[model samples]
Target: MAAVLLIESAMKFAIAVFSAAHAPSSRRALLFAQAALAGGHEIVRLFFYQDGVYNASDAVVTPQDETDLPKQWRTFITEQNLDGVVCIAAALRRGVLNTEEAGRYQRDAVAVSAPWELSGLGQLHDAVQDADRLICFGGA
Candidate 1:
């Protein structure tokens, strides 16, 4: 009799965060992203929508006694070289902008930069198409 072998395949995932930076949902999403990468899974994109755009904002300041989830997210995205996108409309509404956006809006400063791209819903749609699964955290 021949022995059978079983192998698990790595899955491609698209993560969508819809919670604020200080929210528990965002933290869970970050942890999930880390675990997914450690498990040898691929993260196609990290989409920040609605309140989640705050996580991509450089202006977000963490309390001295609290965890800086935004900074952690930025570091993770930078180190892993992942596609981190924030919804332009949502970001604009929330006052989070990149250099280009800031200039376009005649703003004095840029709230988002490297490792965080300000784009549209199309990016999330594209990521979903390329990923095997779409994991979303925090939404009403």
Candidate 2:
């Protein structure tokens, strides 16, 4: 029936995160993402904005007793082959840079790597246009 088809349909989600990796917001976002995927929903993209850029930074070191949310994010994104984008302006301001960005800015270090992309807001806009739902977490 149409109702059963509708109930079984999978949605495409765009997740926007605006908190640091150690923050509860980021953890909640991660859990939501996991649940969404497990429920057969597709993640169109993961957008990291403001402090959320820290979730994609390779330079972020977690305390020994704490969960490494950033690392977990990286692993999940890579394993899922998901598009994970970090806002370039926010990331640069927060000292999180990919190799290309580091080279462009003449920085000697790179704080971000593969599976995480440094891009502008356009990517988020595109994801919003393509996704059926836009879930946001941790913003002022």
TM-score between model 2 and native: 0.93
Query: What clash pairs does model 1 have?
Result: none
Q: Which number leads on lDDT?
A: 2
Give the lowest summed-lDDT range of ten residues in model 1: 1-10
Q: How high is the CA lDDT of each candidate model?
A: 0.93, 0.94
Give one digit per residue, the lDDT tens place, for model 1 in 1-140. Answer: 11222115678999999999999999999999999998778999999999999999889889999999989999999999999999999999999989999899899978999988999999999999999999999988
Give the alpha carbon lDDT tens digit for every residue of 61-97 in model 2: 8899999999999999999999999999999999899
Provide the global lDDT of candidate 2 against the true structure.
Answer: 0.94
- Which residue pairs in candidate 2 have backbone atoms (N, alpha carbon, C) closer than 3 angstroms, thus clashing? none
